[model samples]
Target: MPRALVIEDDHKIAELIKIHLKDLHYEIDHTLDGLEGYEMAKKTNYCLIILDLMLPSMDGMEVCRKIRANDIASPIIMVTAKSEEIDRVLGLETGADDYIVKPFGVREFQARVKAVLRRSLGKFENQSSTNNQIIEADGLSIDLDKRSVQKEGIRIELTPKEFDLLSLLAASPGKSFNRQSLLNLVWGYDFEGYEHTVNSHINRVRAKIENDMNKPSYILTSWGYGYRFNENI
Candidate 1:
């Protein structure tokens, strides 16, 4: 059975999530402390992680950061009562694959979980089906199956979302993907006005892969439209 970790402080909320996840046939591990959740995540390979923004010992942002810093690529769904726009954006920026606001309908919550898991599974299938998995340009190498990147022969770590974003652009060289398009394609959700979230992820990827962020050579701006992988690289 596939397992999931739920790091939530509220008993009611955690119970709600646990019940639904069990319905999806997942083995669940529940914790009220962020530190314990982080430790469990580090030691186990869960198919999904349901993380709350507020918890004892550590905040969700720090926990998410630490998990991603360790290159644990499990899909994460950040659950929180805070529905502010900034909170949602920060959750994504911190490496959560998806986010849900509190007091949410059971249907919406379940839908988000299902969508994230579907996308995660799709990535694995797509990777395994392709024999030609590496895309190279200007000394940057992206291994599609392995989900790894090396810039100028030096391995660079990227969050799972970052890797997905980069892979999409690199595979379609010179195709200018507007922010909304990227948001839909990479995130599996159409967040209408949250284009800046895409911009933030792009900036982080550029910072890691570019020799100079000011003069980026791989990812180029499309002036009035969006971003594209440099075809002439």
Candidate 2:
């Protein structure tokens, strides 16, 4: 069974989420304190993590950043009462794969969890189609089998999402992929209104790989189309 961690301070909310996750056949762990939750997350492995933005001892954003800084790639779903667009974008930038506003329905929550897991599986499926070889372009080397990247002979560390997004673009050099298409392929959902998520991932990937974000060599803007990898590279 898949495992999940729910770090929600509200007793009722946490239990509700736990019950629903259990219904989906997930082994769930719950924590009410942010510090404790962070400790538990660091100590254990989970397929997914559902975290509330507001909590005691620490904030959800910091927790997400800490996990990512530790190189943990498990998908995170951030829950927040604030429905501001800035909050959503900030959560994603901090490394949460998805976010849920407060008062969400059970079905919506379930769908989000399933969608994230599906995206993870889709990544595996995409990798399986490749021959497990390294792709080289303009001094950049990406080992598909190892999931490692090196720029100009220097190893570059990237988040799992960053690497996946770059891999998709680089694998099909010169092919333009619109934001929606990239979101569907990379995020495993076409629910709409999440193209900015794709843009954020692309920008982060470029920061890691490009000598100049202003003049990226690997990934290129397709103007009105969307984004494409540099075929010339």
Number of the top-ranking candidate, with TM-score as the measure:
1
Error of 2 at 22 (Å): 1.5
Highest lDDT model number:
1
Query: Which parts of model 1 have CA positions greater than 4 angstroms off?
Result: 123-133, 150-157
Q: lDDT score, residue 126, model 1?
A: 40
Taking the tens digit of each residue's C-alpha lDDT, what string does model 1 give over 1-233?
99999999999999999998988899999899999999999999988999999889999999998898787889999987664667778888778899998888778988999888766544643444667679899899998867789987888977768888888888878899999998998898788888888888898889889989999999999988899999998
Per-residue lDDT tens digits for candidate 2, residues 96-194, read 887888888899999988887766545555556887567899999988767789988898876667777888888888999998888777766563776
> Which residue pairs collide, candidate 2?
none
Clashes of each: 0, 0
Score candidate 2 by TM-score against the native. 0.76
